[model samples]
Target: MTTAARYATFGVREAHGVSPAYERLALAVAQDDEVLALLEALPPAKRQPNLLFSVVRLLGGPVEEPAAFHDYVVANWPAIEPEMRTRWTQTNEPGRCAVLLPVLAALPQPLALLEVGASAGLCLYPDRYAYRYGEHLLGAGEPVLDCVATGVPLPDRRPEVVWRAGLDLNPLDVTDPADVAWLDALIWPEHTHRRARLRAAAAMVAADPPLLVRGDVVDDLPALAAQAPADATLVVFHSSVLYLVPEPRRDAFAELVRGLPGHWVANETPEVLGCDGLPEPPSEAQHNVLALDGKPLAWTRGHGQALSWFG
Candidate 1:
């Protein structure tokens, strides 16, 4: 309820201060009464109101120069009055800047991004847009999410981004406008800014689509890896998903990821999540980087934060 775990739930600080939209919402943690109520009414089971898990339909956003997010919330009263309905909203929408940077850094240029838990593909389309990290700008409209940790420097030279694709145990295909809208529904109506960002991101997907496959991570990741395009840095990644797999299943999934050809990235911890099988993190924090062979690469402050690269 009270800003759970620094930057644990939202990617507000992850993208840095450039996202005027997210910044506004993050700062709104104080001013907005609705958000405060939602937080106060935090679900006892989860401790935090994850706006990403709802199965309901979210109404679309204003086309251009939309009103402030405050306006949108008032209009969607019936769907969101009780507010905690969409518990996993932010969980599925990728905006965590800290965890994404290092994953990108460890890859070879022109790499093929194969995301394992790509919920609504919010981050799958990161490269297609321009970002604002304070004053810096990166990637004009691609699916790569460039994160700027407070103490870390972002890579100026980008890898040759050959292809961006993802596989999810339950993938949300944006090509299906309704699916995209449903994903939007997961956003907390109180946070108008987030809705705006989701809308803009969805529009991009409407243009150029990312390849998404539906399958279980434990059962499907190995096949996904085998079928990945050759010679590309095979970076397999996931966030907040490890906790859901039962421990035995989690171990199996980890083994599958560890044995894969390229690299692996994960942002999760069983101690702090609803995910079933996860163990305590490699460390206390559910954030860090690993080599393709399962060696610890760097200890990041959080995902997308800086890394203490072993190399």
Candidate 2:
């Protein structure tokens, strides 16, 4: 798809209900040839709406109004282009832990988690946060996550995570203000709750940082997996991480993980994993396919707002 098509689809499928500001901005960007051309100059992967909008937000540019946003993006193209080139759209949403909780809790007694594309390793601390799975609350803490789930056995308790680590091309440090600021910017304009959740999650990780390694997911996975305790179930997992990777690389990573001991949990867009025969998603809104050991189990909202299990 062209950049314009991607932006239009994102506006409709992703931001329509979640973020009005983003929906308007994305639709406007899709129609603006000037802006589209500017985006076309960047690498294909860097042309993502999330990257552009986040960079603008990060640089204090306007995203609420289309005209102003366009002008600012063009005016600041020199600065924006460089940032987009260097940065990846690592939206480390801690809310996604809600979707993973059910599967993680069902795994063996203790788990050793290794996350791919773990920007700040916030998802690594699922045991640290609280969750509200539609009236069935689990744990007690700040930044409580809420998700509407159906046809799923809600976890009775959080998993006992004995070890946790993350692999990213550029692992973000939760303690760094700049890194945290980038994370904050990646969140949609209207998601104040998510911003608050980010702070809480960041602080939690900062208090005791995980072993976040700066390396390629495929090349560096085995070394990191080797570090996991043998006694624990080493569950290698990733959420919204594979789409950025080329198809071949994604397949290679999948193969490598399957060969390793323990389980594998992947929550990604159906197309990302070439998933076939998935039941119809619960709604028209964008939903990722949640699979365990390459078996599709549920359809999940991007930010873990809801889930529909059809295992």
How high a TM-score does candidate 2 get?
A: 0.99
* C-alpha local distance difference test of each model: 0.53, 0.94
Q: Candidate 2 regions off by >4 Å? A: none
Worst-scoring 10-residue span by lDDT in model 1: 47-56
Candidate 1 regions off by >4 Å? Answer: 1-90, 141-148, 270-311
Q: How far is candidate 2 from the true structure (C-alpha RMSD, Å)?
A: 0.7
- Please give, for residues 162-248, the per-residue lDDT of candidate 1 as tens digits: 677777756776677766666666554444555566677777766777777888878777776777679777777776666545568
The residue-level lDDT of candidate 1 at 32 comes to 58
Residue-level lDDT of model 2, residues 1-311, one tens digit each, is 99999999999999999999999999999999999999998889999999999999999999899999999998999999999999999999999999999999999969999999999999998998999987899999887998999998998999999999999999999899999999999999999999999999898899999999999989999999999999999999999999999988988999999999999999999999788977788878899999999999999999988988998
Candidate 2 at 208: error in angstroms? 0.8
Backbone clashes for every candidate come to 36, 0
